[model samples]
Target chain A: MVTRPPVIAEWLVRQTAPADMREALLGDLCEEFVLRGSPGGRRWYWKQALVSAAQWVPASLLLLLPGYLLPLWLLDRLWALLLSSIPLKEDAVRAWPMLAINLVVACLLGAAVRLPSGALVLGAAVLILAASVRLPLDYCCLFLVLPALASKWPARKVKRV
Target chain B: MKEYLGEFEQLVMLALLRLGDSAYGMSVRREIEARTGRDIAIGAVYATLDRLEGKGMVASKTGEATEDRGGRAKRMFLPTAAGLSALQASREAVARMSQGLELEGLVW
Candidate 1:
C-alpha cells in the first residue's frame, strides 16, 4: 500500500506549480512516493520538494532582474507619484495600500514562480518590497525555468500526438 | 558551435532513451538515481523537461488517469529528433574536447 506523502511538500508543490502542470507534476511525485513505498520515502519526497525550491526560487528572481529592473524602476517612480498624491494622514493606513499592492503582486509572483516553498516566501518578500515602493514585479520573466513561467505564452506548442 | 546540453538535461534525455515508450517523470527520476546514484528532485526534472519542451527538444503526452497516482494523469516524455541529435552532438563535443588530454596521472 502507498503511504501518504508529507503534507507540507504536497502543499508546497500545489502552491507553486502552474495550473496546466499541477496534476501531472503531482502525479509524478505521487508515483515516486508509492515506488519508494516507505516512511523514509516520505522524507525523501520532502527533501526533493524543498531542495528544488531552494535552488530555483531565488535564482529565478535574481536572473530576471537584469531584464526587468529598468522597466520596473521607471514604472515604480510613476506609481509612487500616483500614490503620493492620495496620501492618508497616518503611516499605518498609508502602509495598507502598499501592503495590498504587495499581496496582489505577491500572489501574481506565486502564480509564475513554480519553485517551491523557499522561493515562494522569498518571491513574496521581494515583491512586497518592490510593491511597497510602487515598483513592479515582472511575473513574465523566465530566466532559468522558462517553461514554468511560460504557461500562457502563445508560442509554446505542446503537441501530444 | 552547437549548443551543449546541461549535465542534468543530458542525463534526463538519456534516461528517456532507456525508458523508451514508458518514460514519464517518475521513471525518469528513478532511472537516473539508479544509474548515477544521484537523488534528483522531481521538480528539477520537470523543470528541465519543460524547458526542453520549450526548446523543441522534447515532446510529451498526457496519459489516462491512474488510481495509484490518485486519479491524476501521467505526463509521459520522449526525445524529439532534434533532442537526439543534440545529445549526440553534446557527446561528440565532450569526446572531442577530451581527445588529446593526457590524464594518466591526474587522479590519485
Candidate 2:
C-alpha cells in the first residue's frame, strides 16, 4: 500500500503557488514527502507547504493595497456626503454607515484580486476599520466574512493554462 | 564594480558546481542540508535560484517527469561562467577580510 501526503495540504500549496513554478515545486514536495516517511512526513509536508504559502502573502498583500485603499478613500468621501444629508443622533446609528462602506469596498477589492491572501488582508482591514468605528462585535465579524466569500467571485478572464 | 554572491547564494552555487548535471531543486537543497546541517526552506531555495537566474548567474531546464515525483518534471539548474566568477570574487573578499587576523579556533 502506497501512502499519500495530506490532500488538503497539497491542494492549498497548489492553489497558492505561482503558476510557472507550480509543477516543479509540487514535485519536489511530493518526492521529499515519500523519502521522509509517514506520520512525521505529513507534519513536515504541512509545515513546508504552509511556510511556502505564507511567503506569497506579503507580495499578494502589497498587490492588493492600491486596489483596497483607493476605493476606501472614495467610499469615505461618499459617506461624508451622505452624512451631511442624513442626520443620525445615536452613536450606534452613526457607526453603521462606516461599517457598511468598509464591508462593501473590502468585498469588492477581495473579489477583484481573487487571491486568498488578498481576501484575508482585506477582510482583516475591514474588521479593524469596523471595530474602530465602534460597531458591535457581532457586526464586526461580517466585515471579515463577506470579503472571504467574495474572494470566490467568477474570474474576469480565463487563464491560458 | 563586479557583483558578488551572498552567503546563501555562494553555498547554492557551490552546491550546483558540486552537483554538476544532477543539480535540481531537491538535490541542491539536500546537498546544502547535508553539508551545512541547516533546515533550508524549499521556497527560499527556489526564490534564490530564480533570482540567480534573473541575474544570468544560473540557467535551468525542465527534465523528464518521473513516477516518484508524481509525474512532475524536475527543473535542473547549473551555474554560468558569471556565477563561478561571482562565487570566486565573494570567496576572495572573505579571505581579504580575514587576512592577518590572529584569531585561532574562531570557527564553531
Candidate 3:
C-alpha cells in the first residue's frame, strides 16, 4: 500500500522550495514519509514542510527586497515631483497617483518573484502587508489584485530546469 | 591555508563519506540523525549540500528515479578533494586548540 503525505504540507514544500532543489527535496520527504508510516509520518511531513518553507521564504524575501523596494522609492520620488510641479496639495486628492504607483510596483515585484508552484501568494501577502500600513480600501484591493494578475505573465517566469 | 569547514558542513561531508554511493538527501539525513541523535531537517541538508557544491567542495549527480520516491530522481553528493582537506584542516584546528586542555570538572 502506498501511503501519501499530507497534501497541503507537500504543496507548501513544493511552492516555497528553491526550484533547483525541489525534486530531490520532495523525493526525500516522500521516501521518509513512507518509511516512518502514516501515524507519525504525517506530523513529520508537516514539520519538514514548515521548516523548509521557513528556510526558503526568508531567502526569497531577501533576494526580492531590492526588487520590491527600489521601484517604490523611485515612484515615490516621481509622485513627489508631480505634486510639486502641479501645485497640488499632498492630501487624499493627490494620493491617487501614489496608489497607481504602488500597483505598478506591486505587479513588477510579483512578476520578479513568481515561481512555478504558485508563489504569487507570497507576493499577495507582501502587498497586503504594505497596504495595511498606509493604503485605503481601493488602493489595497488594487495592490492585492495587480500582483496576482501580473504573476500570470510567462515573460517574467523564474523557474529552473 | 585551506578554509575550514563549518561544523554542519563537516557533518554533511562525513555523512557523504560514510554513505559512499548512497549519499543522497534522505540517507545523509538519516545517517547524521542516527549517529548524532540530532533531528536534522532535509531542507537543511539540501541547503548545506548546495552551499558545498557552490564552494566546489562537493559534486552531485542525478540518480535514477525510484517508485518509492514517487518517481523523483535522487541527487547524490560526494565530497571533493578540497572538502576532505578542509575537513582535515578543521579537525586539526580544533584538536590543536584543545591540546593539553582540561576543564575543572572533567579529566582527560
The numbered model that scores best in lDDT is: 3
TM-score of chain A of 1: 0.50
Candidate 2 per-residue C-alpha lDDT over A99-148 given as tens digits, one digit per residue, 9 for 90 to 100: 67576766766565663333544557667766887867866676467645
Q: What is the lDDT of residue A91 in candidate 1?
A: 55
Question: Per-residue lDDT of A1-161 in model 3, one digit per residue for the tens?
Answer: 44988899998887677666788899989999999997799889999999878887777656445555456556767887887678655563654557766666656665666623335555666676767687556644653455346434453222121
Q: Per-residue lDDT for B69-95 in model 3, tens only? A: 989999888888888999999999999
Q: Write the per-residue lDDT of candidate 2 for residues B19-98, one digit (tens) a residue.
A: 99998888989999999999987877886887788788988888878887898999889888888899999999999999
Write candidate 1's Cα lDDT for A84-136 as tens digits: 78857765454323433533444355445432223344445455555666632
Q: Who is ahead in lDDT, 1 or 2?
A: 2
Residue pairs in collision within model 3: none
Clashing pairs in 2: none
Q: Name the candidate that leads on DockQ.
A: 1
Interface Cα RMSD, each model: 1.6, 5.4, 4.2
Residue A116 in candidate 1 has what lDDT? 28
Output the TM-score of candidate 1. 0.71
Ranking by lDDT: 3, 2, 1
Model 1: residues with Cα > 4 Å off, grouped in runs: A59-76, A79-123, A127-159
